[model samples]
Target chain A: DAGVTQSPTHLIKTRGQHVTLRCSPISGHKSVSWYQQVLGQGPQFIFQYYEKEERGRGNFPDRFSARQFPNYSSELNVNALLLGDSALYLCASSLAPGQGAYNYGYTFGSGTRLTVV
Target chain B: DQQVKQNSPSLSVQEGRISILNCDYTNSMFDYFLWYKKYPAEGPTFLISISSIKDKNEDGRFTVFLNKSAKHLSLHIVPSQPGDSAVYFCAEGGATNKLIFGTGTLLAVQP
Candidate 1:
């Protein structure tokens, strides 16, 4: 079976431009989460969606937004991107919101490497 | 303020030796912890996890120990192999299922 997948493995964009990253969760999984990993640092949570609803959010700025489609795929949109916005965007999926052991050891996708020049 | 912290930036160990990675957190509400391993250009993969009720959780070749009193935890890998070289992350979260991660520890396993 196919694991989680992300699109546009890498992209280069100018500052102030908008970017949308995509993700497809595992076939049977109902929850999808987004994370941002800066160079040399661990990933920070962004947003989570289950059954097309927003379940959780992180400490990121208001410029970041996300949505989950009925098919369990997700899209993370970053508006007015800054040079600091460059990082790896990861997508993960799990059975459900209250089901995962710690809500942490998720199955992650390879990630979209976003570069804001 | 950083809730989870992995002080060590990197560690080196010889093949077949024991490797210990440490993590500490300041959040008492965090009842669950997990370890994830990542390679270059790849996202982190789940390694192991432990709940607050238990002080230890073990999997083949990998084990995680938690000390709730001190808010510290460690991951032990016995007989470390070259393939084990990767960056390890410690995560803490609870009902929100929103994980807070540490800076990560890079393990370099030598032949």
Candidate 2:
């Protein structure tokens, strides 16, 4: 089975532009989470959705939002993007929220690199 | 303020030797601690995690130690291999179920 997959491996947007990144969760998985990783830093969780409802949210502003589709895929939308939004947007999937099976462990995809010009 | 922190920017260890990575957090509400290893240009992959209930947890060659009082944790890889080289991050989980991450430490295992 394939791991979590994210779309548009790279993206560029203007300071005031909006950006949307997509992710497909692993088969049979019901949870999808979004994270932003700045250069040289670890990932910070943005949002987590389970069963199409918001399960958790990070300390980000309203400019950052996300939704989970019926298929467990997710989209992360950032409005009025800022230069600091330049980072790798990662999508991680698990069997369920709160760390998943965590035995074989949680899986992460090659993230979408977003650069705000 | 950084709730989670990895003071060491990098670590170098010889192959077959032991590799140790450290992390610290300031939040008293953090109930879960985790270690994620990220390769350049790739997303972080969960390495190992330990709940606050236990001071120690182990999986194969990887072990995590948490000192709640000190707000510190450490990851140990025995007989470290060159393949283990990567940037390791420390994360803390709280009521929000969101992960707060540190700056990460680049670990290089010398052949």
Please name the candidate that would achieve the greatest TM-score relative to the true structure: 1
| Candidate 2 structure lDDT | 0.87
Residue pairs of candidate 2 with colliding backbone atoms: none
TM-score of each: 0.97, 0.92
Interface RMSD of each: 2.2, 2.1
Residue B53 displacement in candidate 2 (angstroms): 1.7
Label model 1 with its docking quality class.
Answer: medium
lDDT, each prediction: 0.91, 0.87
The C-alpha stretches of model 2 lying farther than 4 A from their native spots are A99-105
Report clash pairs, candidate 1: none
Clash tally, candidates in order: 0, 0
lDDT string for model 1 (B1-111, tens) is: 548999999999999999999999998876689899999988789989998899999999999999889889999999899999999999986878878899999999999
